[model samples]
Target: MQITVNKTGGFAGVNQRLGPVETSSLDSGVADQVRRIVTESDFFHLPEDLQGAPVYDGFHYAVQVLDGTAEHTVILAGMSDDPVVARLHELIHLLDEAVGFQWI
Candidate 1:
């Protein structure tokens, strides 16, 4: 499995890309964490876009996951009322932290 995260459109207009990292090579615990988030967030079942109207200073995230021949992508805003959106954001944030990136 592989996962990639691209973050853009924050207050500073920062754009960052992390991973395309291979989950199987990651520490078992971290890989498990990623798997748990993917399952709990129902990431593969989500729409291709979750973006709403742009909010000034709000961030946007695009996440992609690949497992075997299957692939899924989800884009979401910085804040949302949808539980899946919130969970995906949390998952990405946790991943960023795990990879040593400062949280936004």
Candidate 2:
């Protein structure tokens, strides 16, 4: 699994990261566990909106999910008190890889 996180536009102590978890690389059980942990979650509870919300220090978070890949961008004018928000974004990407909907 390749995971990467970049910290920007936030308070000095805030942290952010992202990664690509290869489902083919994980053991079936382990992969299943990861899948269970990550899924389509609600961002409404977060301190921002999907289209426009402050994430950190005059920034916002834009999340993009794809098969075997997830990308995130922190928009300025954002502030995040909770650290897990970033982790959750990465997890959501993994979930999409694990068992996300697809059109074929």
Candidate 3:
């Protein structure tokens, strides 16, 4: 399993990419969390674009997941009230802490 996170459209106008983070190379706990998050959040079936409150200086997130059975991406605004979006946001934070390759 692999996951990539891209954060863009922020105050500084700088874009960042986080992985293709290989689950095999991560700690078991973190890797398991990724699997659980993807499954429970229905990551694969989510709409590709999840537009949010659209704050002018807010960040945008693009998360791509590629596991053995499927591949999908979800893009969302940083500010939102949706539960699923919140979950994805948390997942991004988790990745940032556990296997980060870029600044958030």
| lDDT tens digits, residue span 1-104, model 3 | 89999988867985888987988888899888878888899999999999887789888888999988888999988467888898898889889998665655
Model 2 lDDT tens row, 1-104 = 33222333445544443344455566687566554434434322333333335444543333433334543333223444444455555555555455442322
Candidates sorted by TM-score, best first = 3, 1, 2
On TM-score, the candidate that comes out on top is 3
The parts of candidate 1 lying over 4 Å away from their true place are 101-104
Q: Choose 1 or 3, whichever is better by lDDT.
A: 3
Residue 20 shift from truth in candidate 2, angstroms: 2.8
| Model 2 CA RMSD to the hidden true structure, in angstroms | 9.8
Model 1 CA lDDT for position 56 = 83
lDDT of each: 0.80, 0.42, 0.86
lDDT of 1 by residue, 30-83 (tens): 889889989887778889999876788988788999988889989887446887
TM-score of each: 0.84, 0.32, 0.91
CA displacement after TM-score superposition, residue 64 of candidate 3 (Å): 0.5
Candidate 1 Cα RMSD after full superposition onto the native fold (Å): 2.8
Q: Candidate 2: list runs displaced more than 4 Å.
A: 1-7, 12-17, 27-30, 37-62, 68-104
Error in Å for residue 16 of model 2: 6.5
Root-mean-square deviation (CA) per prediction: 2.8, 9.8, 1.9
For candidate 3, the lDDT comes to: 0.86
